[model samples]
Target: MIRAQLELRIPNMTAYETITAAKKSAIPDDAAMLRAAVELTKDISAARAAIYWPDCFLSAALGYGALAGAVLLRETWLAVVCALVAALALYRALLFIHELTHIHRNALPGFRFAWNVAVGIPMLTPSFMYENVHTLHHARTRYGTAEDPEYLPLALMKPWSLPVFVAVAALAPVALLIRSAVLVPLGAVIPPLRRVVWERFSALSINPGFRRRPPEGEFGRMVFWQELGASTWAITLIASTQFIGWRPLLIALAVFSLTAVLNQLRTLVAHLWENDGEAMTVTAQYLDSVNVPPPGWLAPLWAPVGLRYHALHHLLPSLPYHALGEAHRRLSAHLGAGSTYAGAHYGGMMPLLAKIARSTMGRR
Candidate 1:
């Protein structure tokens, strides 16, 4: 019964059809082409792949510093300017957490800890929430299925659902604060609430029906400590509001909200979201994903931290953020314009969004 209901909700080419069609049009030997691309870029150093820690920290510092300065200034024009700068910086810094997930462990030791302390705690989006969840989205058999926690059929849903999807993110800072400050410690003491938090609040997932298994071993320990750190920071921030005056707190909230909104927009165009709740072939998944290539001067501003190459990232998940641009260049040159690789390149976000909008409206 549940399977039937889910099938009813998915409104596009069935998974089998999509996969077959994609394979027919794909490069004759995608694996070989990808291997060749990998060989071409193999010399890219892992150390260089590591997030530039100074830049990450400095960006966050400048963002928060601007926010603080804005609060002090109390001038509307200056506050708006500072708030926009802060939002862009925070968005870029927070995106490094995605890089944290893909980084080779030995390639960047202690970077995760530094990220959690500086950007994660303040933004209320600790790395633990994304760690286990994002990997599932990359899993070949799970990419477009209900099991893919990071996916939701936003492009297939009702037209009104798009704005609501992005608008909800504006409340994330407050929601995260409540989850960290109130739910974390309370759940630690109550077994039932603990289960609830673990299954629901602990993951940065979009699929409401998705449930998480309890964490165990080293990853479990990391989750526990990261949550504890976030809880501590949330409590401190909440308690300090009385003494520090609420203006700074308000400004921080504005920046955080704006950052979340920007992230929502980036995510909106990440994929075509046309899969019908079934497993997809690598080629199909690549086709479903998107890439906004060159001269989209503002692409980096909106989809920073290597997300502008999202489709290419799907092709080579292990490719470091810093190396994606180079990888894309090599692949484009080798594969030529006629390949399936060219199909994934959208040129710009506006075109992608319009395509998704048409998809959504046409279905109704």
Candidate 2:
């Protein structure tokens, strides 16, 4: 009966499929199921200013405080512990950039500027980098293709590619440093370099072929201030090596490097990565995304800020992170374990990582 019902209903393609030729997945269509996701989440759609403010601020505060502790503490064991705490907290704070993209412009006024001041510029990953770009990943037609900046056909790649994917992320802190300090400063004087930098280096993306359009209007103005802020901070950081010495700066980079790796690991399992550069149905995109809900306590630590429910977020992009847990509960109960909605649920990070790695090996 359930199988029969799923076949009768289906919807449009995902952000990966929003642009070009989007074909329905071979899996049975679940139009009613998709509708249920929207209907169930209606009550929780509003973003709460209270939650948004504290979560981002507190996390960034704890991260920076711990980072300072790590740099100052002389004992090896204690400093190592502080460094780990700093990395995890900062990683949580950094992931808020994802939220900034989907959130309404006026939902949390001054949030963009405050966040850039607190975490974004310091990390060299301001909201402007992701604000306009990430929406394409959720576009009705662009997902899973060369155009989807966040989508990569990783499951179909060679086994070696998986390790390389992670290794590249470890260098993110250093790469971002150069981008802010050197490239951006030079781009200010040279129009062509500015265009190339905007198109190529400005986004937080996974697909190499995904080029960003130049920011214009209000967004372009936002980019200018953010670029200036990041450059100034980056120069300050570089100058600090002369006054305070390289030890402190290097230590800070080390903490951020670990934070970057943790984020990459979380991102790896956020989806099934089985799209193969083709358009996917909305349900296919949801299924391609993985949900690590309950009984997985470790998920919150790593995939913090409702990111543990990534697949669900794809269903309701506007839903605030705080409400996702209750939303997941309601949807799971409404749909049941055997339903198409439950197909995206997974246990933990390692298993999901193993699954993706195995798929790369042709075992899937």
Whose lDDT is greatest here? 2
What tens digits encode model 2's per-residue C-alpha lDDT throughout 1-364?
A: 4344334432232232222332334444477788998898888899998998998999999999999999999999999999999999999999989999998898999988899999999999988889888999998677787889998889888898889999999899999999999999999899899889989999989999988888789888888999999999999999889898999999999999998888889889999787767676677788778789998899999999999999998888888899999999999899876666777788899989888888788733
Candidate 2 regions off by >4 Å?
1-24
What are the per-residue Cα lDDT tens digits for candidate 1 across 1-364? 4334323322222222233333222312345455765687787636462347876888889888877767777789998898898899888889988877777877777888988899887788889888878989999779888899988877668888787888999998888989999998899899999999889878878788899999999999988888888899999988988899777777788788999989998998998887778776676687788888897899999999889999888887877888889888888888776565676778778887887887789666
Provide the clash count, candidate 2: 15
TM-scores for all predictions: 0.90, 0.93
Q: Which consecutive 10 residues in model 1 have the weakest lDDT in total?
A: 9-18
Q: CA shift at 250, candidate 2, in angstroms?
A: 0.6
The models' CA-based lDDT, in order, is 0.79, 0.85
Which stretches of candidate 1 lie above 4 Å from their native place?
1-29, 45-51
